[model samples]
Target: MAISGPSPFLRYGVRIANEAHTSLDEAAETLGLLGYAVVDSGLDADQLEALRARFNAIHAANHASTDVERLRAIGEVDLLRCPLADDPLFLALASNPRILELCERLMGAGFILNQQNGIVNPAGAKTYSQSAYHRDLPYQHFVSTRPLAINALFCLDPFTLDNGATFVIPASHKQEAFPSDPVIAAQAKQIAAPAGSFLVLDCMVYHCGGTNRSAADRRAVNHVYTIAMMRQQIDLPAYLGDDFSTDPKIRQLLGFNHPTARSVEEFISQRKAK
Candidate 1:
């Protein structure tokens, strides 16, 4: 059987959650129990469907074939340019107000819009070693002792275990590092969200994109926001930095107003401070 207890990752936030209510309260509660929270929104189903179409079109053209290579031994690929943000249909998701406030509370007062990615998992892609059991922390250039990293997934289509939905090990963020021998497969009770429903995960949790055994492609928009220390997996500040502060949606993610100093060099400074 799998070992179980309060995940070391969620210890602090969960404490803060039990003390409050509302979305803020829920966030604290997630920290206490699950190590993350899904803030509800009215970004709506239509918006998500439209965004999906926009992504599928771009996804088709972005490649000569829909066949994209993935590290399937670990199960999935984190594709950075999915074109959802560029599509007008995705405007609401790119700029949701509730998510912005949550970013400020969890990441920091000067958080950064770390990365915006689109994930595509093909049918029958292998699982297990593909993603391996890991926390989202290993790749950080800058980080905090306190958890300040957050990733949100916009399920463009319904997410299910049979076809690859993102999976997590309850609250696993508290671990200093990821498990090398974590042999359990992703829980079947995965994040099966409706279209437009967004699920957020604390970067500390052990997670990976599950295998897609069905023919339909499993797609999602992954938007991650972080404290100043973490280097984004994408060229964030360069692409979105100038308009980040003034862009109301982006601003909420930043906890910061101006992001003129964003660069890899900035990441080094952040790493040093920690």
Candidate 2:
């Protein structure tokens, strides 16, 4: 069939899908129409100050970048073997409602938090450290089907033009990858939202966090929600474990069961983690 749509992934489901106009679901649906499967909001005013406090602690403790942690943990494998889900700061980041709503829209009825991490884009950080365009989901090991996934990065500091912000190729999720052109790379759009802005993105879309050249650090928290079928990078069971109720939403997210009756897929398999 000659499709008259942007792409299958871009297909925005039905309207009034989330109790009509008053819900965040409607906003998510609208974002889907643009081939972006996620939506993010400004940080809730109530938690902004607390977030700032936590950001400083994370920076001082040298836990801002995954690559850094991954390297250090590998060297001292015993000390860092624990899954990242148990981190209290991470838990706080995962509970953001704006993130919850968008994840639900893309991953279906019971999307749950899978990962929490941070990045402090300091001024004059190495260029490659910011990363080149890539898809978070395309490279992950998946089973018979692709589970839905969404990712959000909340800018703790204002992402301005001078300081680098994330750059995304709109509608690129359907492309699976981007074209190779020096000109396009130079002209690609940068998403520079102010502090407190949430730059949510579809997991499969091609994007890259930009380099920071400003006089200060540009911080953000990176969190991901995956459909129940997929193995979270950090096991849910190990993270929240027994501290909370086991509702289906919480259970599936805790890696107790697959939500929506889906299958499990992992890059590196382990019987106990899930």
Candidate 3:
């Protein structure tokens, strides 16, 4: 049978449009329409190398010995908990004005860093758990009128097809429901971009890691930002403590501004005290 609509991935020119885009508004608009957009992170080769070294140091400290161990402790290897504490670069990149701007456009003024993790897909690492096609906010059953979360992937190494570049379903974020059929789920396109590329994506988009078939490792830093009203995936405030709470922008993004009232009465009382 003849195809009805153009392939979702094809419609976006995702595979072909591998050039770096620098405009924040253009990137935001592309993401709004296609569920994701890849743009230059403005990091040069030296910066990329430094970031990679920092990530490796943190990963080594965690003692991810084997592929099985790394896979088993993906959260640990990925530095899921308090990654900002692991490296200062994490804080700088996650809070970059360009990144914050896109997030603010999607999630309003106050956006919380829901999660930041290191993604290292090494070759011959069998039994890939991250390869499962899924959404970041998997537990949420309902859709929000506005995007509840924005995810940015900071590429530490070039994301090539063979090294398991991320696979995403274009326009899937707009769907009120998840794809049920296996065939429908298989249509996701792999996003290939060079090192120093930052991919911004809607949290609701259907996406997943592809298997690492190449000899080299595929590395990226994943940062997820959510509406400030929602609780962060990790208690960034507790980990960061009161010291880094001085900056207004960082404080707000870290959810320090979120009220700690026990109830409506207490909330009012606390507000009155302020």
Ranking by TM-score: 3, 1, 2
Top-down lDDT ranking: 3, 1, 2
- Greater-lDDT candidate between 1 and 3: 3
**Off by more than 4 A, model 2:** 1-26, 35-46, 62-89, 138-147, 244-252, 257-274
TM-score of each: 0.71, 0.68, 0.83
Q: What is the lDDT of candidate 3?
A: 0.77
In lDDT terms, how accurate is model 2?
Answer: 0.59
Candidate 1, residue 210: Cα displacement in angstroms equals 1.2
Candidate 1 has what TM-score? 0.71
Top-scoring candidate (TM-score): 3
Q: In model 3, state the lDDT of residue 185.
A: 55
lDDT score of residue 238 within candidate 2? 51
lDDT of each: 0.62, 0.59, 0.77
**lDDT tens readout by residue for model 2, 13-44:** 65643233434655465445433432445556
| C-alpha RMSD in Å of predicted model 3 compared with the true structure | 7.1
